[model samples]
Target: MSVGDGRRPEPRYSRIVGELRRRIESGELAPGERVPSTREITRQWGVAMATATKVLTELRHEGLVRAVPGVGTVVSAPERATAHAPAPTAPAPTAPAPPAPAAPVRRSTPSPAAAAGSPGGLTLSRIVAAAVTVADAEGLTAVSMRRVAAELGVATMSLYRHVADKDDLLVRMMDAAIAERPLPADPPPGWRAPLDVAARQLWGLFRAHPWLAPAMSLTRPQLITSAMVYSEWVLGSLHRHGLDDQSAFTAHLTLLNYIRGLALNMETEREAEAQSGLDSEEWMDTQEPALRETLEGGRYPQLARLSRAGYDFDLDGLFEFGLQRLLDGLAVLLDEGTPPTRA
Candidate 1:
C-alpha cells in the first residue's frame, strides 16, 4: 500500500536519515564536514532526542558518517561522490553554430551595503545584523557562520574577517540587541520606581527576542557595555537604600539572576511547544484531569484549596509579587535596622 493509503509510513527517523543522505549526495554538505549533533537535530527538526540519535546511528551504520575522537561525527569520504563528479555532457552538433567563446560566469561578492562597512568595507556590525535577522526568523540554531555568510551573499571565509567564529557572532548579536534598548538617562524618583522600570525594560527586551534569555549567562555575564550600563542603573538604585557597594552589587546580581531564570523558563516553554506540537494551554489541558483527580483526593488540604481558587500563576504576577516582597524586606531593614523577614 502507498504511504497514506493505509500503511503508517516509515518512522520519522528514517525520513531524517533519507534527507541527510540526500544532502550528502547532492554535495550540499561536503565530506569531512561535521554532521548535525543529536541536540542540534532535535532543535532544528523538532524531533525527540531518541529519534535524532537514531537518525545519526543509522547514517553511521550506512558508512555515511564516522565518529572522529576529537572532531565528533563527520561525513565520510565514501559519501563524497557528488562533490568530485563531472558535469553532464551536452549534445555536440546542435551547439556548433559558430566558434563562439564561452561567457564567464560572474561571481558575486559581498557588497558594502550588505556588510555595513565604511568605504574600506565589511564590518563586524553588518555580519552580526545579518546573523541576528536569521536567528530572529528561524531561531538561534539556524545562526551559523556559513548561514550568516549565505544571507550576506559572501564567502564563508569572508565572515572570518568580521567575526572570529559562531560563538563570537552570537556574542556580538546579544550586544547589538542590548544596545538597541534605551535605559533611563537619569534615575527616577525613589529606589522602587526606578528598579521596577529597569526590571520591566529588561523583561521587555527578553520578550522581543525570546531566544536571548537562554543565550545569556548571569555568572559570566557577556560584558556587553549597554547591558552593563543597565546593571549599573540597578546598582545605583540599590545604593539609594544605604547599602554599601558590595551589598548593592550583590542585590543587583540577585535581581538579574531572578529575571534571567524566569525568562529562561519562558523561552523553554516556547521551545517545548514548538517541538512537541503542543502549546502551553494544550499541555496544561492534558494535565488537568490528572491534576483534578489528585487535588480532589485532598491529601494536602492547603494545596487543594489554592488549586480550587483558580490561580493562573502567571509569570508577570509572580515576578511582581516576589519583587515587592523583596523590596519590602529591604524596606524593613532600612526602617528599623533589624533583620528582614525571610520567606
Candidate 2:
C-alpha cells in the first residue's frame, strides 16, 4: 500500500543509503577515503547489521564505494566529476562562503588510561568491560569482535589483539563479572547462612546481567578462574557440615545448577519481552484465559484452587521456598548421616 503518496514508500535502508550518498557528495567523506564500516554504521545509526550492510552494498552497486584489500571499503571516484570538470571560476562575492575545511582524521590508539585501568596492558579486564557494555545494551547475541570494537571506538582488528575470538571474549566477560563479586572470606557460623548469602549474591549478578545465565554451561563449564573460586568457596563452606570432598563438590554443583536453571528462565522471559515488546505481565494476561480454562477443568484441582486464591509466582518467593527446602534436606543429611537428596 502507498504510505504518503500514491507511490509505494521507500524502505528504511534506502533512506540510510540516501543520507550516506549525501555525505559522499558533499565531500564530508572524500573520494578514496574510507567509508564507515558496517560495524560502525550499526553502532552510529543504531541499525541492524543487515540494514547497515545493505547501505554499504547499495553504495557499492551505485559505484559510490569500492573495497580495498588492505584498508576497508572507500568512497569511489565520481565518474561525472572526473569526466566533466569546470575550470575554477572567480569566487562569487554574494554567495555564502564555502564551509570551513573538514577536520583532520584522527588515528585512535588504545589509551594508556585504558591499559592502566586493566591489570596489564590491554588485559582481559578491559576486554571484558567492552564486551559487557555491548551485552548490557543489546542482548548477548549482538556482541561480537566487530561490535565491541565499534563500542570501543577502535578498529575490529584491535579487539583480536586482546581477545582470541568472540567465545574467548564471552568467557572473559563472565570471569570479569564474577570477579567483581567478592566471596565471603569466612563462612558464617553455619553452612546454611553462608550458602544462602552466596546463592543470593549469584542470583543478583544474574539478574543484573540477564544474558549471563545462558552464557554459563553446566556440562562443559568454561574454565574461568573467578567462577572456580566461587565453587571453591561453596565447597569449603559445605566441607564443615560433615560432608566428604566428593559429596561437598556434588552439593556445590547441585546448588549452582538450581540457581542457574531458575535464572535461565528469568533471562529467557526478559529476552522474550525485549524481542516481542511485551512485558511479563502483558504476556501472562494473554495466556490467562487458556491457562484458566485448562486449570478449571478439574484435572488440576489443587492448582485451580491456588489460582483462585490469587497466588502470584514470583522468582524471589520461589527461590526462598526452594532454598529453605533444600537447606532442610541438607540439615536432615547432616544430622542423621543420611545422603542428601539428589538434584
Candidate 3:
C-alpha cells in the first residue's frame, strides 16, 4: 500500500494483478490456461499470502480468470461474438488505477529491497524468501531469478543487485530454510535420547520442507552453517559415548544419511501426488491388485503373508522403527566399550 507522502505508489497486489492482467490480455496466458496459483503468486511476488489472494481476487472480479475446483485458476474465455463486435461510437471512461506499489522497503535484512552494502541487509531477503517459498510449495525446479524477481514485483536485473546468481541464491535459501528452527539448548541425558531427539528434529524439518532434502548434497553439501549445527549436536552425542573422532564423525554421517534417505521420499511422494493427482493412500490402493498378484507367487511365502495384512507406510513410523533397530546395534558397541574403529 502507498503512503500519503505524495508518491502514489501502487499497492503490491495491484502490481501483481497488472502483470497477470497483461498476460491474460496479450494471450500470453490463453483462455482456460492455468494462471499462477495463489501459492505461486505469493512465491513469485514477495508479497504476503493475502496480497497474492488479492491479486487473484482482482483478476477474477475483472472477469479475467475463474477458478475450477479440481484444476485451478484459469483465464476466463472471452465471448467470441461479443469480442468481435464493432466498437461503440463512444469509449467507456477508464477506471482510476489502483495505488502503485509502495517504494521497496529498504531493510537491513532482506525483507524486500535492502541496500547491498548496508550492514545486515546485504542481499534481498524478499527475493530469497520468495525463492524458498517457491521451493517449499512447488519444489526447487520452479524457482528462478526471473521467477523470483517477478514475484517481488521488480525487474529481473533488480535481483542481481541483491543476490549473486541462482547458485548463490540457492545456498542462501538453504541457510534460511534450515535456520527456521533452532536446535535445543541442552540435549536430553543418554546418547540414545540425544540421538533420537536430533534425528527426529531433522526429520520433521525435512518433512515440513520436502525440497530441503534435495537442496543439499551428501558428497559436497552446501556450507549451510545452520545445517552444520545439527551435525555438531549429533556428533557431540557420540563423543560423550567415548566414540573416537572418526567413529563419531562416521556415526554422524550415518545417522544424517539415514534421515535424509527417508526424507528424500517426502518430496518424491509429493511430486508424484502433484503429477498424478492422487495421494499416497489413493495411489497405493490403485496398486493393491497388482501387488497381491505379485505376492501370490509361491516364491515369496513371507511376502504373501504380509500382503494379506495392510500396512500404513507411514514415514514417521518407518523412521522411528529403523532408528531404534540401528541404535540397538550401536548400543551393543557402546555396551561392549569398543570404538567403531576397533570394530
Candidate 4:
C-alpha cells in the first residue's frame, strides 16, 4: 500500500526478479548451477507461471543467466570488468575522489522483445511450432506460454496475439500435429482398409509425439479441425458398411479409444526414463530379481511359467492383436446387421 492513496504495490514479478537477482549477484547461486525452473519458481513465490517466466526473462536480459537445453536455466559466469576499466592513475590526495560509477546496463543476451521484431517476425505458425518443439522434447508439463515464448525468443505477452491462452495454444498444437500426417488422398476400397490406415496413422503420430496422447481429452474434446478429419474419414467408412449413424460413430470412437489408451503409455515410459535414467529394458533388468522372487512363491503359477520362458513386453504387438480382434468383432456385427448398443 502507498502512503497517500494506498495504491497497489509493484508487480509481484518485479519483486521476485529482485530476489533472484540478489541470489545470483551474491554468489548464493553459483555459475553452471541450475536455478529453480518455472514450476519451482511458481511454487516458491506463489506466483503464476507467467510471473515466474518474467522473473527469468529479466535475469537473462541482465546477462546474469542463460538457458541450457535439457538443463533448465543456470547462473552464468560473472562479467569481468577488465575490458571497460579506465587507465590506471595515481590519485592526488587533495583531489576529490570521482563519484562511484553507475552500473553499466548489460544487455548481453537478447530480450524476447528484441527477438520478436527480427526478420520473419512472430506469427501464429511460429508460435505453435515453438510450442510443439518444447512439448515434444520436454513433455507437456514443460510447455507454457512463457516457455514457448522463451523458445521462440519473443515476449510472452506477444503470444496472446496468436492464442487466447495455454488451453487455446494446446488445441492449435494438436491441430497442427494432426495435420502433419493428413489422411490419404485416395481412400482404400473396403471399410477395413481405410480404418486400418487411419488407426495406424494415429498410432504413428502418437509414437512420434509422445505428449500428444495424454494432452488429448476424451470427455470434453477440443474442436480440432484436423483431428475431426480423421473422425469424418472413419465415420464415412463405417457408414458405407451399412451401419447406422450412432453405430458408425460408436465404432469410430471405440477404435480411437483403443489406440489412445495404448498411446498413453508412451508418455509414461518417457517420464519414467527421464526420472530414473533407465529405459524400459534396463528398468526391467533392474527389477528382475524381485520379480522372480515374487513369482517363485507359487502365488501365480501361469505367470511363473511365463516368467521362466522370458516374456518380452511389446506394446506394438499388443496394439496389433487388440486391433485385429476389435475389427473381427466389428465385422461380425456388420455381417449380422446388429447395431452397437450405447454405453
Evaluated with TM-score, which candidate comes out highest?
Answer: 4
Winner by lDDT between candidate 4 and candidate 2 = 4
Candidate 1 lDDT by residue in tens digits, 1-343: 3866887878889888889888865657666677786656877789976677778777777777764322345676652234333232442122112111111111134353545344346667667777766665456877798887777666788888777788888888888776766786888887867877888777766655666778898767776777888888878777777878887787777777777777776667656766875444335446767887998876978888886654444565666777777666666655644454454
lDDT of each: 0.67, 0.68, 0.69, 0.74
Question: Which predicted model would earn the best lDDT?
Answer: 4
Candidate 2 pairs with clashing backbones: none
Q: In model 1, which range of ten residues has the least summed lDDT? A: 98-107
Query: What is the descending TM-score order?
Result: 4, 3, 2, 1
Clashing pairs in 4: none
Query: Least lDDT summed over 10 consecutive residues: which range in candidate 3?
Result: 94-103
Off by over 4 Å in 3: 1-123, 336-343
How many residue pairs in model 4 have overlapping backbones? 0
Global lDDT of model 3: 0.69
Candidate 4 lDDT over 20-104, as tens digits, reads 7777655677666767766578778899756777787777777777653223466765542122222224421221211121111
Indicate whether candidate 1 or candidate 4 has the larger TM-score: 4
lDDT of 2 by residue, 1-343 (tens): 4576789687878888878787876667766677777656767788875677778777777777764322356676554232222222442122121112101111133343444433234445555776776675566888888776665556667777777898888998888777767777876777878888889878766765667888999999998998888887777778877788988888888888888888787656757766775444435446767998999779999889886665444566677778767777777766854454443
Candidate 2 root-mean-square deviation in Å: 18.4
Cα lDDT tens digits for candidate 3, 131-204? 87677667888889987765555667777877789999999888877776668899998898888888877876
Distance from true position, residue 236, model 4, in Å? 0.5
TM-score of 2: 0.61
